[model samples]
Target: MLLKTFGWSFAVTAAGLALAGVLWGWKGLAIVGILSILEISLSFDNAVINAGVLRKMNAFWQKIFLTVGILIAVFGMRLVFPVIIVAITAKMGPLEAVDLAINNKDKYEHLVTAAHPAIAAFGGMFLLMIFLDFIFEERDIKWLGWLERPLAKLGKLETLSIVVALLVLLVTAMTFATDVAHGGGDKTATVLLAGVAGLLTYLIVGGISGYFEDKLEEEEEEVEEAEEAERAEKAASGAQKGSQGATVVGLAGKAAFFLFLYLEVIDASFSFDGVIGAFAITNDIFEMALGLGIGAMYIRSLTVYLVRKGTLDDYVYLEHGAHYAIGALAAILLITIKYEIHEVITGLIGIVLIGASYWSSVVRNRREEAAGGEDAESKAEVTSGV
Candidate 1:
C-alpha cells in the first residue's frame, strides 16, 4: 500500500516537474519541489477536512476526481483563472494577459501582485461561505450544539457571502476612487469599471452557481437512501469485511479524491496569501513557482497520509478541527484583503485552531468513554440486585 501510494505520487511529481522543465529545465524542477513542500505544511488542516468529505463518497467518483480535478486545479484555476484576473483587473486584453503571463515573468508577477486584493476578497468570502454553510446545515453529530442554534438562524452563509463580497468590492472601488487617486478620472474610472466587472463575475457567475447548488439536495437525498439500504443488507448477511473490503477500498478512493479537491481549493485559497506573499520574498517568477510547487507536493502527500491512516476516523473530530482552521484562515484572508497580514501569522493562527480542536475532541472522547464505563457498571449492579 505504501509503495503504491508513493509510486503514484512520484509519478505525479515527475510529471509536474517535466512540464516545468519544458520551460526552465532542471532549475524549474528544483524550484517547484521547494514550493510544493511549503504549501503542504501550511495546508495540513485542508487535508484533514478533505478526508472527512471524501470518506462519504464512493470510489469511482474518487478516481474521476484525481484525474479530472487535477486538470481543474492546474489549468482551470491556476493557469486560466489568473490570466482572467489580469485581463479584467489589469485592463489588458484577455489574450494579451495570457501571452504576457506566458512570456514575461516580471510583468506576470506584477499582475499577480496587483490582483491580490481581489483574490483575497474572493477566497475570504468563499471560505466564510463554506464555514457558514457547514454551520447552518445539519451535521451528523453536533459538536457545537451550543452555538448551532444561534448560527443556524443566520440562514445560508453562501448568500451572505455574496453580499459581503459585493460590499467589499464597493468599498474597494471607493478606496481607489476617492482615497488612492492622483485625481486622474480615467484611471479611477478603470479601477471602478474593473471593480464592477470583477463584482459581476462573482455575482452572476460564482454567486448563481453557489445559490443553485443547494437545489441539488433532492438528488443527494435519493443517493444517500440507496446507499444506506445497501449497507444494512450487507451488515445483516454476516459477511466479514476483510481483504475483499471493496466498500473500504471504495471509501478510501473517495476520501483521497475529496482530499485532492479540497487540497486544490485550499491551495487555491492559500495561493492568494501565498502567491501574493511570494512577491515580497522574490519577484522572480521561477523562484516563486519553484517554492510554491514544492510546497504543494508536501500538502498532497500529507493529504494522502491522512486518508491512508484513517486519521479522520481514528481522530474523530479532526475534520472539525480542520474546518475550524479553515474558518480562521478565511477570517485571516478577509483581514489581509485590506490589511496585508504576514504569511507566518495566517499559518500560525490555523495551527492554533486545529491544535485546539484536537484537544477538545480528545476531552470529549475521554468523557464519553468514562460515561460508558459508568453505565456498564450500573447495568451490572442492577442485574446482581445487590
Candidate 2:
C-alpha cells in the first residue's frame, strides 16, 4: 500500500533532483531537496485536512484531485500564481512580471516580499476561518475538550465563526499588520481589504459546498426512508426475504465540484507562506517550482493514502490536531506580518500538536480495549456462577 501510494512521489522526486542537478549542479539539487522537505514538513497538516475533505468525494473526483489538482498545485500555485501576484502588486503586465522573475531575480524577490503583507493577511484570514469553523462546530469527538466543549456550545449561535474571524482580522489589521517597525508603511487599508477578500472567498466557497452537502444528506435520508418503508411492507406481507439495498448517492456533480474548488482555495491559502518563504532560500523560479511541486505530489498521495486506509477514522484526534495546527499557523502568519518567525517554529508546532493527538488517540483506544476486556471477563464469571 505504501509503495502503491508513494511510488509516483518517489519518481517525481528523482526526476526533479536530476533536473535541478542538470540546471544548477549539486547546489541546485540540494536546494530542491531542501525545498521539497520544507514543503512537506509545512504541509502535513494540510494533507490531513485535505484527506478529511477528499474522503467525501467519489473515486472519479479523487483521481481528478491527484491529476488535475496536482497540475494546479505545481504549476498554478507554485509558478504562475507567484508571477500573477507580482504582476498585480508591481502594476506590471504578466510578461513583465515573468521577465522580472527570470532576468532580475533580486528585484523580483523584493517585489514579492514587498507584497507579503497583503498575502499574509489574505492567507491568514482564510486559514483563521478554517480553524474557527472546525473548532466551533460540534463534533462527537473532542481532542481538546476543555476548550472545544465551550467553543462548540457557543458555535450554536449563528455566524459566530464569521463574527470571531472578522474581529480577529480587524484587530490584526489595526495592530500587527500596520506596525511600521517591521516595514516602513501603514498597510491598514491593504491588510483590511485583503483580509476581507480572503474571508469572503472562504464563505462563498464553503457555503456552496455546504449547500450541496446538505442536499446530498437529504437525498440519502430520503433513500433510507424509502428503503425502510419497503422493508416494512415486505415484512407485513408475510415475506421473509431480505430487502434490496438502497442506492445511495455519493458526493458528485455540483457538490464534488464546489468541494474541489474549496480544496484548491484552501491549498492556495496554505501555499502562500511556503511560496513567499522560498524566496529566502532561492530566487530561481524554476527551482522553486520543481522542489515545491515534488512536495505537493507527495502531499496529494498522502491525502489519498489516508482516505483509503481510513487513518483518520482510526486516529480520531488526528483531525483535531491538524486544525489546531492550522489555527497556530494562521496566528503565526498574522504575527509574522510584524515579526519574523522561522519556518522551523511553524513546522514544529504542527508536528508537536499532531504527535500529541496521535498519542492521545492510542491511549483512548487502549482504555476502550481494557474496558471491553473487563466487561467480557465479568460476564463470563457471572455466567459461570449462575
Q: Give the best candidate by TM-score.
A: 2
What's the TM-score of each model vs. the native?
0.67, 0.94
Residue range 194-281, candidate 1, lDDT tens digits: 4454345434543443433333344345446655776977542335334335554544543444445444565576566666666655
> Which digits, one per residue and each the tens of the lDDT, describe model 2 over residues 273-294?
8898787799999999999999
Question: How far off is residue 173 in model 1, in Å?
Answer: 6.1
Which runs in model 1 stand beyond 4 Å of their true positions?
1-3, 10-33, 91-103, 138-148, 153-267, 284-291, 297-310, 313-316, 384-386
Model 1 Cα shift for residue 166 (angstroms):
5.3
